[model samples]
Target: MKLLALQGFLLIIAVEMVAVLVHQQHIMLWAAGVAVAVPLAGLRRLLTTGDAGSADGVPIIDEPGAALRQWLSGTEARIRWSESTRADWDRRWRPTLAGRFEVSSGQGRVKDPAAFAATGVMLFGDALWPWVDPGNVAPAGEDGPGPGRAVLEEILRRLEQR
Candidate 1:
């Protein structure tokens, strides 16, 4: 605002000086009117039109990009997880699975380790409970091969259904 005021004032002074030399002092009034009105008019248009590329006001999100990126990242991680060993599952995926079960439980609150274990048991039932049991955070007794892709897919399906 200070700069705009200075510019308008300077324009008025210049116009007035030129007007005096040309013996037409009325030109100063025209200069002052143009300086004030032109800026205000531009401001009005700018405010009403909003973003240049999106004249409707709000900017749009790339939903497909976001969804696809997330899916790809998760798929890539799951591929690695499937290729890992029992010890790796205990170290990595177990906590993630336990967290999901706990969050999906009726309590909807962060809880103690015991509560997380109970939630995992209840959600996964007997068959898969061993996979994500919170009490099973200790290193696996064996570095045996992981259950692989089909098992992981079944686990995902079961989780989604639950």
Candidate 2:
């Protein structure tokens, strides 16, 4: 919105400048045409490139953990935090040091633990980190959606924050 306003201001200034500097009628007309054309291009770009979050419906998980698990299955992992967590990553989550994100795999490490765990939280939420431990921030209650869908929404919110 700010960008569009700035472009409008600039277009007004340019049109004024062109009208003042270009005395001949033909040159002035050409300049005006170019000025309008430039701003139209900018407007087109602004309208086309919009926020991806403004979609119509909420992002629902049809198959619960299975979809995310399958996505992770194809992911490449450089390190495995635990064989157990890796084994149950789909149904029940056990946090580990390393995790493979949606597309790229094996990129996370001990230093950047979020690289792997962030996606896991999005996929499994409370299952990934039980209430018994600390640093658990999963959503509460069953008001809006089921556990799987709620976790999926949480994941989307987390991704948008990034």
Candidate 3:
């Protein structure tokens, strides 16, 4: 609204300046007509613009999954994977991943680490599973889409796929 007023004011000022600079009466009339027509066209466009909202008054791309995907991708870059901090990652992210979607870790003792690893791989993919093993650390600088971020992204993709 303020922009429209400002533009109208500027157009009027320009028309007046042009009128003052030129003595010819016909050019002055043409200048005034142009100034009025331009603002009227702009006003028509503004008034005719359609509502972006649906009947529910909601917008597309506003889902929780979109936000989660962005967060997971951003977090991947900040994580500096190191051999010394294996326990920290396990304690921090394991429960987070499990509790995030409210999935149970299943019953009793986890007898087979490979099967457990496979389950994590299936859910989160190979990017996260190797980190579960004490010996496996993702090679440094492999945090691009094919690995680190790709791991969590695969999970988000599957979730959104539903």
Candidate 4:
């Protein structure tokens, strides 16, 4: 995504340079317009539809009010949320709607200690998991019992019982 953006920007610059070299103000204006419009169109699409993932290059988790449940019998996954970290995964991936979604680490391998240890070293070195929603606009407040809050509560309850 970053590469694409860079390439588009370069193309725009190239177009402007060519226009300047030939003294074609009209053509230069058109090129400039296209250069701006193309990226803006892409940005609009991203904002309207919330599917932004770097690896996949598309929105991964797209369901509204969606909750991801990962059962890690051996090792845990790391998660991060937009509201807490302010990392803006969405913006980095999709500039229009950059900070609208969450990203998380996948359930890693943990069947064997030696092998798991090697992989675990890499996994643990990465970011945190279960990047939950920041409970934005929850009438109950940040810690109040909203939908996401309820889900977290249930998960905690289940973990405690286990």
Q: Which candidate should be chosen as best, given TM-score against the real structure?
A: 1
**Candidate 1, superposed: residue stretches over 4 Å from native:** 1-74, 107-119, 138-141
- Estimate the lDDT of model 1: 0.68
C-alpha RMSD for every candidate: 7.3, 17.0, 13.0, 20.4
Q: In model 2, which runs have C-alpha deviations exceeding 4 angstroms? A: 51-162
How much is 153 displaced in model 2, in angstroms? Answer: 24
> How displaced is residue 152 in candidate 2, in Å?
25
| Candidate 4 minimal-lDDT segment of 10 residues | 96-105
Q: Which 10 successive residues of model 2 have the least lDDT summed? A: 78-87
lDDT of 3 by residue, 31-109 (tens): 8888888888877876687334455646344687898888987766435322224344444443455444233445112
Residue-level error in angstroms, candidate 3, position 133: 50
A best-first ranking of the candidates according to their TM-score comes to 1, 4, 3, 2
Number of backbone collisions per candidate, in order?
0, 4, 0, 11
Q: Is candidate 2 or candidate 4 better by lDDT?
A: 2
**Which has the better lDDT: candidate 2, or candidate 3?**
3
Model 2, span 1-162: residue lDDT tens: 566568777886778687777666566677767777787777777578643322443434357889788778654231121222323333233122122233333434354556545654554455633321123423443223223434434443543454
Among all windows of 10 consecutive residues in model 3, the one with the lowest summed lDDT is 100-109
List TM-score per model, in order: 0.47, 0.27, 0.31, 0.36
Per-residue error for 77 in candidate 2, Å, reads: 30
lDDT of 4 by residue, 1-162 (tens): 565577778878988998899988878888899987887777677667764675667647556544333333211222222222234322221221112221122222333334433432343222221222222223322342222333334433433342
Q: After superposition, how far is residue 108 of candidate 4 from its true place, in Å?
A: 35
